[model samples]
Target: MIPTTDDPIGDNPALIVIDPQQTTSESEEAMSSGAASIPGGRDAVMENINTVVEHARSADIPIIWGKELHRPDFADYGAEIESCEPEHGIVGTRAEQFDPILSIDEDDMEPAEYVIVKRRYNFFHRTDIEHILRTYDIDTVILVGFMTNICVHYTAHGAHEHDYAFRVAEQATAAPSQDLHETGLKCMRYLQPRGIQDITDITARLEEYDGNQLVKRVKESGQITPKTGPV
Candidate 1:
C-alpha cells in the first residue's frame, strides 16, 4: 500500500523486472502454435513495467533485470519444459532476445544496472542475487515480470526467504488467464500482505521521489545544482 506520508518505495528502492523478453511477435507465433497465452497481452503489461523502470531510474534505484536463458537441448530446464515451455525454451531463436521496448541499449542500462541470467525461475536459486542486492543496499524489491503464476510467484517467495521486502506491480505481470493472474497476486500477498500494488500507485510515489532526492542532493552539495537524474 502507498503511504499517506513518505514511502520507502520512493527512496533507495530496487526494481526487479523478471523475464520481460517475450514479445508480441512471440505471442503471435504462440497463438499459431498450440501454446496458450495468459489473459491481458504481455506487451501491455510490459508497457506498464517500462513506466515503472523509467521512474525507478529517475529516483536513482537499481534496476535488476532477469532473463530466462536456457540451453536448446533442454538440459538446464529440468521439469520446466514438462510444465510449460516445452515448445518455448530454445535459445538464439527470434523470441529469445528481449523486446525492443524493453531493449537494454535503448534503456541506457549501465554495467551497474545488474542483469541476471538464470536457468531457474527463482533468481535466488543457486545465484548470487542475494549478495548482489546486499551490495547495492537494496532494502525493498519492486517486482515486475512475466508468468505471474510461475517465475514472479517463486521469486517473491525467494525475496521473503532472503528477508527482503517486496512489492508486486500487479498490472505489470501477466499469466495465462485473469483468474490465474489474480490467484498469483493473492499467493504473493499471502507471503507479504501489503506487497501487492497497482502500477499507477507505484508510479505516483516514484514521481514524488524526485523531490526527495533533490532535497538530499542540495543538502550534500551545499548549493543548488542540476541533477543528472538518479544514479
Candidate 2:
C-alpha cells in the first residue's frame, strides 16, 4: 500500500542518487539487450534528476550519491558480476564520473551529503552506505538516478532488507527501456510496498518536517530502540 501523508516513514528522507555517470561500452551492450540504460537516454533523465537535486538541496536534506568504481586489479568479484571491469575501463575511469549536466560540483556538495563508491549494483553491498545512514539515524531513502533496473533497483531492494523506509522518484530514474524501467519499479513496490509515492508527493511530505527534526521524533517515539541488527 502507498504510504499516507501522516506516515512518519517519509519524513526527512535521504536522497540516494545512483550511477549517474557517463555510459561505457559495456553499459551500452547491457542496454541494447533491454537490461540497462538510462530511460530516455542521459539528456532527458539528467534534467529531471537535476530538479530533484535542487529541491533536496533547497530543503537541506541529506543527498547521498553512489557510483560504481573498480580497482586496478580485478580483485573485487562484485565488479565482475556486474560486468564492470577495469579492462573495459568501465569503473575507476573518467567515464565513471557523474554526468557534467547534473552540476555536481565537489565544492558545492554539502558536508552532510555522502558520495559512496561501490563495486556492485547494490549500494549497501560491501559498502558503508547503510552504516552512514544508521549513524545519521535516517529512516527513509528517496532513490534517484540512471539505469533504473540495475543499481537503483538493487539499492532500493537492499534498503528493504535493511528495513529502511524507501521511495523511488519515478521521473528521476530511467532504464535502458520502458519495460525494464516499469518492471524495476513494480518489483520495488512489491518489496517495500509502503513508501512508493512519486517525487512530487515525497517532496511535499518532506516539506512538512524540518531537517534532523524527524530523526528526533523517531528517537523520542521509540521507533528506533537499541537494536543490534544492521538497522
Best by lDDT: 1
lDDT of 1 by residue, 46-66 (tens): 677788888876665667888
Global lDDT of model 1: 0.69
Error of 2 at 162 (Å): 0.7
* Backbone clashes counted, model 1: 3
Task: State the lDDT of candidate 2 residue by residue for 24-54, as single tens digits.
Answer: 6655555432332334555767787788777
Off by over 4 Å in 1: 1-11, 23-40, 106-108, 210-231
**RMSD of each candidate relative to the true structure:** 6.6, 6.6
Q: Once model 1 is optimally superposed onto the true structure by TM-score, how far is the C-alpha of residue 171 displaced, in angstroms?
A: 1.0
lDDT of 2 at 38: 35
Kindly give the stretch of ten consecutive residues in candidate 2 with the minimal lDDT sum. 31-40
lDDT of 2 at 161: 83
